[model samples]
Target: IEKEGWSGEVSGRRKDGSPITILITASLVKDEKGEPICMMDSFVDITERKFMEDELRIKDNAIASSLNGIVIGDLEGNITYVNDAFMELWGGDDISEIVGKSAVTFAEDEDKGRSIINVLQNEGNWTGEITGIRRDGIPITVQLSAGMVYNEKKEPICMMCSLVDITKRKEAEEKLQRSHEELEIRVQDRTKELTKANIKLKKEIEDRKIAENTLLKKEKELELKSLNLEEANTALKVLLRQGEKDKTELENKVLQNIKELVLPCIEKLKIYRLDDKQQAYLDILESNLNNIISPFLQKLSSKYMDFTPTEIQVANFVREGKPTKEIAELLNISERGIEFHRNNIRMKLGLKNRKTNLRTYLLSLA
Candidate 1:
C-alpha cells in the first residue's frame, strides 16, 4: 500500500464507457533490491451504494422541508428520528431534545398513548385523529397516519407517522352547519307570514266583489224609478193642453149665446112708452146686456192684470160704444171719474200721450 494504504472514495470510468464510482487501495510491489517495481491497485465498485446514498439524502431533505410533521420510531415506541417539521410541531427548538424521548410523550391523553402502542404492537400500523400536546403544554388536533417499517424478512422494525393539522378546518365546518340551520329557520318564518297575508288578501277580494254587486243593484233600481217619473211628466203635459182648449171653447159659446139670444129681446123692449126715469132704467139694462156679450172686457181684463174690477167695468162700457156721460150715470160715478179710469187704461195699455183713440184700441182687442 502507498502512503495512506487505502483511499476513501474515488471517481472512475468503466470499460463500457459509462461513469462509475469506486473505492481504491494502492500498494507497491518491490524487487529484492528493495526498490519499487510495479504499482498494484485494487478498485471496489460502489456505484449502486453511491446511488442509494444519494437517493436517501434526497428523501431526507424532502422530509425535513415537508409541511406535515414526519417521525420515525422503533418498536419500543422510542423516537429514533424526527424531521424539522416534527420538532416545530411539538414546540421543540432542536432535534436532540426529542430524538431519544418516547414517541408516546406527544400524546395529550393517556388512553390515546396506550391505543397507539397497542396498534403498533398488534397490527403494526395506526391512523386516525389524535390530540397532541406541544412543549408549551397546549393541545392541538392532528390527523395522524402511520405505517410499519419492515425488514427484508417481513419483521416489523420501526413506525413512521405523518401528522397533518386540521384544527381550523374543523372549526369552519361547525360554523357552516350553524349558519345553515339559522337560514332554514328564517325561511320557515317568512313562509308562514306569506301564507297569512295571502289568506287576508283573498278575504278582501271576496268582500270587494260583494260590495260591487250591491252597488250595481241599487243603480238599476234608481234607473227604473227615473223612467217612471219621465212617463208621468209626459201625461201631465197632455192634460194641461186639453184643459186650455176646453176653456177657450166655453168662452166662445158664452159670447155667442149673449149676442144672438138676449140682444134682440132688449132691442124690442125700446118700443114700449115709459117715463124719463123708466126709460133711463131700460137703457141701463140694454147697456148691461151689451157688456155681457162684449169680448173686449175679457181681453182687457186678461191683458192688464193690475186693472181693478171697477176699472174693468168702465173699460167694458167704453168699448160697447157708450158715451162717457152714460157710463158715469150707469156706474153712479162722476164724469171726471170716468175720464180718470180711461186715462189709467191708456197708461196701462202703453198708449199714454199718443193719438190712438181709446174706444178704437178697446174695440181692436175684440
Candidate 2:
C-alpha cells in the first residue's frame, strides 16, 4: 500500500507466470459534492523488488547467500509472500504453493508458531528467532522481524517481514559463552588452590622461624648449662666437705642442749606436774594451731588444683570445726544461703552430691 485509500501488494505476472511483489499507491479523488467520483493511484512496478528478490535467489544459488530469510503474510496469516531465501531454506518453491495456506504451517512446532501468531495479532508486530522447515524438510533457525501493513483507516491488512539465518552465529556465541564460563570456574578453582598453598607456605615459614629461634635458644642454653654443670660439680664437692663438718657440730650442739637446757626445763615442768585441765589446754592450743594453718595448707594444695576462693573459704570454715549455721553467722549469711553457695561450689568443681564433704575434698587436693 502506498497512499491513502490505496491498498494491495503491487504485484504482476513474471515471464514464467510467477507473481512478483510490487508497491502500489492509490488515492481517491472527490467531486465538489464530496463524493468519491474518480480515483487517482500510482503503481510502482517494483521490478526492483522483484529483481532484488530474484537477486537474493540468484545469490543463494551461488555461494550460500548470507541474506536473512524472508516471509510475508496477509493480516489473516495466509502466506502471500516469501523470498527466494525462504523457499531455499524452507520447503516452498512456487508462491502459489503456499499463497492461500496459513504461513504457520512451515513452523517446526505448532505451539511456537501459534505463539508468534498471537503476538502478531495482539501487538500488530512480532520479531524473534523461530524454527522453520527447509525445502528438504530440515529444521533451520531464522531471526525474523515483521510489521503489519495498514490502510488509511489504520486497519492491518498484511504483514511484511525480514529474516536472517543466525544458526552459525547463535551456535558460535553459545560455544564461546560456555567456554568462557568453564574458564572462569577453572580460574576460581586454581585461585582457591593457590590461596590454600600460599597459606600453608606462610604457616611453614612461621614454623621454620619458630624452630630456628628455638634451636638458637637451645644452643645458647646448652652452652650455659655446660658451664653451670661444671660449677655445680665443684660446689657439690665443697658443700659435701662443709656438710660433714657442720653435721658433727650440729650433733654436738643438739646433745649439749638436750642435756643442759631441755633437761632443766623438763625437770621443772615435772616438778609442777600439769593437772588434767592444763593438759587439756595444751591439746586445745595444738588444735587451734592446726586450724589456723589449715587455710594456708588449702591454698598450697590449690596450686595443684583449681579451687575458687569461695570453695577455699568454705573448706576453711568446715575445717575450723564450725557448724554450717555458725559458719554462716561468721560469714554474715543465713545457713540456707551458705548451703546455696556450697551447692554452686560443688557444681562448679563437678561434684555429684551435696553430701560430698567439701572440707574432705579440699584436704584431698593435690
Per-model C-alpha lDDT, please? 0.84, 0.71
- For model 2, what is the C-alpha lDDT against the true structure? 0.71
Q: How much does candidate 1 score in TM-score?
A: 0.52
Question: In model 1, which runs have C-alpha deviations exceeding 4 angstroms?
Answer: 1-4, 28-40, 116-128, 206-366
Clashing pairs in 2: 10-22, 68-164, 69-163
- How many clashing pairs in candidate 2? 3
The estimated TM-scores of all candidates read 0.52, 0.42
Model 1 poorest 10 in a row by lDDT = 288-297
Q: How does model 1 fare in lDDT?
A: 0.84
lDDT (10s digit) by residue, model 2, range 261-332: 655554465557689866555544444345434445434433434655555566566655568897676567
Candidate 1 lDDT over residue span 1-366, tens digit each: 645455668887878988899888788878999778989888889999999999999998998899999998888788899888878788888788888878788888867887888888899788898988988998888899988889889999888899988878877877998999999999999999999999999999999999999989999998999899899989988997998799779878977887888778877878888899888888777766666565666666556779987888888788778899988998899999999998998899888989998889888998
